[model samples]
Target: MVNNKQKDAPHAQWPEAAQTLIALMHAQGEVARLSEREQLISSLLVSVNAVLWAFNWETRQVLYVSPAYERIFGRSAGLLLADYNQWRDSIYPDDLEYAEQSLAEVLRKGAVEDREYRIIAADGQVRWLSDKCFINRQDEPGQPVIIVGIAEDITDKKHMETELQRLATTDVLTQSSNRRHFFECAHREFAEARRHGSPLAFLLLDIDDFKLINDSYGHPEGDNVLQRIAECGRGSLRRGDLFGRIGGEEFAAVFPGCAPDMAVQVAERLQQEIQRLRFNHDGQAFSITVSQGLTNLTEADESLDSLFARADAAMYEAKRQGKNRIIAA
Candidate 1:
């Protein structure tokens, strides 16, 4: 309670002790600061959506994993730390080999930044991950080699990309391949067929009296007919055949490895399917028909344009002769 001398006595009697006391106080402050820093780092890791992990490659063990492991994988981090296979088992079966191979690549390359794969979460939901990993340490005399990585959930991004691709490649109303996408694929198929000398048939189809139907039944019904026709084309074609809506009331198909006879049968089946389709408007039922022009890849053909010209001319010929018929070129 009282004294200036009392406070100074210890310092005066043992100067070394006083210095040690001061050093001890500073150390305590440093410890507290370190603890706060650690807590802050922990909090930041927990708040992030990506999982950060460290693995002891020599021992084949997981050294540490962030809290986001549980959130993204829907599995316990404790289980992962206990057994590395927990992570392995979660990888999609088809992707497991590539995942392991790519991770191993990090050893040679020191980093793998372009890795992406799929994993099945604990809730049985499949999620995509863009996992980038690096060698945290090189092999030392006695130190354990460490591999560190960050795994980010990219399911939403993958889905968005897929939807974007579908939109870019698909017709909105007919749900068939769009004209540009169809031509792109057809040209590739044409080159392949030419290279292999394989039979390739192209068929062009046009709905007969389409304007009259649209005027009588309204544009909505016309759209419905187009969708139905696309559905028929999809159902009637072989697995590898390509079909698309190329223009208003006009559709195209590329049949790879299909001979002329088979292509004719397929075109006939599609025609019959369209004929069987019955649409109703204002209590009146009506049926639609299509004229098809079919052409086979000839030795003289150089590009898809030539095939298109022949098929277009043949389709016009069919339309001129009569409606609802198939003509071969």
Candidate 2:
């Protein structure tokens, strides 16, 4: 059985699918056709994709739930006996307060608004969601008042957002963080260091003579070298460390709590790790070495551009000094 919260189920006690038809027929009568309008309103409530939470402002009893309520909520609205506060048990704990506040506001002015919240499925799965409500208020005796709302499933949109974030930050080839994301994340680390008066370090690494390997062995062999380097980088860094594929044969590492000297130690370790990488192509075994540049975060100005400039300059110095060496800036 599908739950009310599952986005596909029955929610209406009275089926009113013909009200839209009534609204279209403009009748020239002396008196108002109140029943026709009411029917149209009820059918609309049943057809909407969102949950229609309707209540009598005076009685405080829920008068209606759109047909999709069970589909989106999992629980039966009729079981609550028109007491909408029964939603307290059905709603996700984190969203209950917001829901209650919105309900209060709606009751106060019958204001129309949309809200997003996490709700529990009938089967106990948590899902992200949003709902739009259009409320109608009345303050007379022997007359019906209603609050109409539509609900839509936004879980797919939320998942898409998360996946996009991953793509933006992660390198497609090596599944490591990408260069842009590396810099973006490193800035946050730098800010924290500046706030706490801590040290931050960076290492800019490049494979030694990678073009020579590509020329002699072919691009495939060079790719193997890069992949091997990525694995080594992952193995060398600790948790909370950020390492990225900064370029074709270049990489970067951000160490949040390390001094310039310690950064040099890390750069040297990475260089040694790269030297230990062994690969075989067409039954031929070979090794590769890496040159690295190190830099420390300073209180003078903790900016991404400044740090990158220092690291890049130090990296060029390492490259100039016969490659395979570490230079600090």
Candidate 3:
């Protein structure tokens, strides 16, 4: 028989060695899983179109910034993490106060959901951001006060909103104020004039023999004439004057803070300008004229409607007496 002590010693240590090997394998598996999870999170953050950030409010330090920061802000994320002032400097100067105030409001309110502002990127492009922030430790007094936020690029949305507003308020043909917008602005001006006892004038003008022109030359030529007249009105009016195309071949103007004599002079100048415009259609040349009715604010006037009525009446009188002149009511 062999030596029994030596055989028993080898047998005794095998179990311990096996246990150690098993433990090491389990630890390696756990580490691999954790690495995969971390990689997944990094990929997700890189693909997102918004910036996710975390900051230490007490220390005023940027703790973390997502990959999208570089794309949206055109700046380095490393610089931002090194100094929080990078964020402050990137904000549009006009919006800095509001941005900081709104961010600070998150501490008291626990969240700020609708903070929209502009930021100047590294390349000098102004971009709009819809940033929402929250206080992570609002209830824990002893913990570090951390602020976490997400900012989305909203420049395209802001541009779309501006375009829609322009389309709503503007005339397509003449690019002047439409009838509804004109009245809305006019009502506000009328109220302010009434409150201050300021001088204001209303003028209604219509193209003379417009039907004849349309019938003789066609609607295209008629549209051309209308566009030219609108241009003349825009060029002749004062800075504060409001002009609009209220109807076909009809335009209206409101002159705020204009005296009666000055209003007359302006109308006369517009008349001469229109009289000088010459157009050719089908190799035949023709000229156009306009009839205008003007009225000034009076102590006895009750409302803007009264002024409109007086101007309308005077405009018809001008049409009846002669075709191409202005009459004051």
Candidate 4:
């Protein structure tokens, strides 16, 4: 019903306006999608097993903590949020200094921070946590920097690693330190004694006539004897003493503050205890004796090897002389 000029004029403007409306609709949809995605991510972080946290440098405060805080720390999130010290105080005393150093380094140098430390939970369980954080600087010249991080519970992994290390360093048969671990420990102790001029003693002990026992009573009985001797030695030694099984039917002990005279008494006591140990197999009962060689840290000693050599010679002398006596080198 309209003229051609009127219809053409309206149609010409309509395409531009329609295009604008379509573009606006698309922009709105995109914003909504982003918002929904952000919400989903936030929800996931709160429900995740790991704890999410944010700290403000200016306020020296914890600005945010995800819900997993309660699960990991065995305390209410409200307590932590209300008092920042609540979390700081929960850190194990031994690890507090290291944690502080890590945080200082991150803040001062904008470094990527990663640390592992232990924390005592409210339930009295010790838990290990692995923390990783990154710094976010504000655009303004004097604004507070923010730190964002995640903390993961790593107690099981730490325990497994500790058990593996123990197995590696311990003798499986005697349940004492192996030869390598013993030497490693002795090296450190020797250095310490030399540095501080402290008295230290080393003892080399061997079972007398062990081969005869194995031949007479079978290898199993010999093994039981070794285990029993190790148990007795462990019980008789001072708390600070280091004992290890270095070879078949041979063991070593390091005494960190004991003089040569005192070490002789210790060896004599251990010998008596070994004699007192009674073993019953089937219907027979028997006892065993040990030969010991004792040596004290000397000014001439340069290395653990030198000390061990002297002790070994003395032990062989004990075996040669009556087979069940203490000899000093």
Candidate 5:
């Protein structure tokens, strides 16, 4: 317990009470060390803007919730540490098992993993985040030392991914799904509807005399017609419907949960809209029209070949009828 004065001081000058006070000061040094450790942890949490969730290895219960919990998730660690479900329930339902599975895997291997999941906010808004942690394997039975992790908000990153997906699947010119992306998506919709015993329809459409327009007024004018028609058709489409360009001046529409008759009605509207389409080129007014073929696939198939074949046949039938008309098959 002696630091400096205790070793050199005379016994008469240092009474029993003075020696006792020196011992007490040595004890206070231990207290100061403890305080410094706690402050270091507090500063660490604040510096990185992180919530540290510390768990005891053997009890499998949370031992500490750093104040960063309030700063990040708008909740107190005191409440969260008392109940594990408070944090578990905040995770998105779809990601709940993922989180549990990841933890189980980590425990078995004593490894660290960086994972992400959605968190439901107090305002009922959902956000995504990622965590990084090190698995502490200190002296314990069937346990670890401490499970500490840091998390960050990735909601904006998730939104950016969604917008990028839209760009990949859509055609900038016609505002329709591109040909390759359309078939991939349509086949999925067809298979799902067929599995559920639901009805579905497909429509094949082509502008009447499209080549003549391109040959006469040029491709730009013809493109103008296609864009306008897309806008008009999209206006009448249901939220789940899809329309896409499959070839030059050729388009396909997928009608999920709709019967053949309903598809025929949709085709009729498209026909009328195209028939009435008008545009001006260099102050010379002109109009364009289209012929459409409509068909339904009652049987489920992995390939869109058969469905398109039927619609193609029906479309030729419309073309043969002098164009600017809809024929259902």
Candidate 6:
């Protein structure tokens, strides 16, 4: 009963209205999907113990910070968000200047910057952090420059590195500096002594009858003897003294600010201490002695090697002179 024009008008408008509704729904679905994906990625970063953040360089404010900031930095996200200085104050004093300089460089170049530095947590624990930041410049006029960044807690990794370095430079048997580390330290001490014209004494020590002990009681017992000798020597030396195991049954000590007479007295006391050590292995009780050679820095000595050679020669002379005495070179 309706007019033909009127009937066609409603039908034509229906398709256009439906299409617009469908497009709106699709757009909403896409927006929701993107938000979910971003949240999932953020959760992943938190799971891996990383903090994600965005900073506004021009405004000098933190625009965004992940939840992981509370976990890693031991500071609440709300607190840091309210005041940027809360995060800045957490940085260790020594590292703050360097970090500022690095940030300045990144802003100047408008590129990525990476730095490793130390931070003090709210719990009074010192932690290491590795930070990577990328500059995001705004194309629109009057928009603030932004910095997108991530920071990771690298304290455990840093500890592992430090322990590895210690193992590399230290002797496993005596827990003293190894031969290579000994030389490295000695070279530096030698250079400084030469520059300042200071008195520096070097002493080489050898375990008396070490081979005999190894042959008599096996290597384990011989190891015990060496450890005892090292303990005695360490107890006799001062804190500033450099003592290290230079070879099997051979050790060396560097005494800075010690004269030839003081070196002789120290060597004598160390020999006495070693002689007093009583070692009991498998019901076999015995004592050991050490022979030492002493030398001092001299203008005639051109290099560490030359000085060490003279000390070695004197140590052999001690061995020749009854195997339990100290000789000066």
Global CA lDDT of candidate 4, please? 0.90
TM-score, prediction 5: 0.65
**lDDT agreement with native, every candidate:** 0.95, 0.78, 0.94, 0.90, 0.80, 0.88
Candidates, ranked, lDDT: 1, 3, 4, 6, 5, 2
- Which prediction has the highest TM-score against the true structure? 1
Which candidate would rank higher by lDDT, 1 or 6? 1
Using alpha carbons, what is the TM-score of model 6?
A: 0.86
| Top candidate (lDDT) | 1
lDDT of 1 by residue, 99-216 (tens): 9999999989999999999999999999999999998875567777799999999999999999999999999999899999999999999999999999999999999999999999
Give the lowest summed-lDDT range of ten residues in model 6.
Answer: 105-114
- Write down the worst ten-residue block by lDDT for model 5: 49-58
Model 4: runs farther than 4 Å from truth?
1-13, 43-48
Q: Write the per-residue lDDT of candidate 4 for residues 145-193, one digit (tens) a residue.
A: 8888889999999999999999999999989999999999999999999
TM-score of each: 0.95, 0.67, 0.88, 0.89, 0.65, 0.86
Model 4 — which ten-residue stretch has the worst lDDT? 105-114
Judged by whole-model lDDT over C-alpha atoms, candidate 5 comes out at 0.80
CA shift at 120, candidate 5, in angstroms?
A: 5.4
Estimate the overall C-alpha local distance difference test score of candidate 1. 0.95
Task: Kindly indicate the candidate among 2 and 3 with the higher lDDT.
Answer: 3
Whole-structure CA lDDT of model 3: 0.94
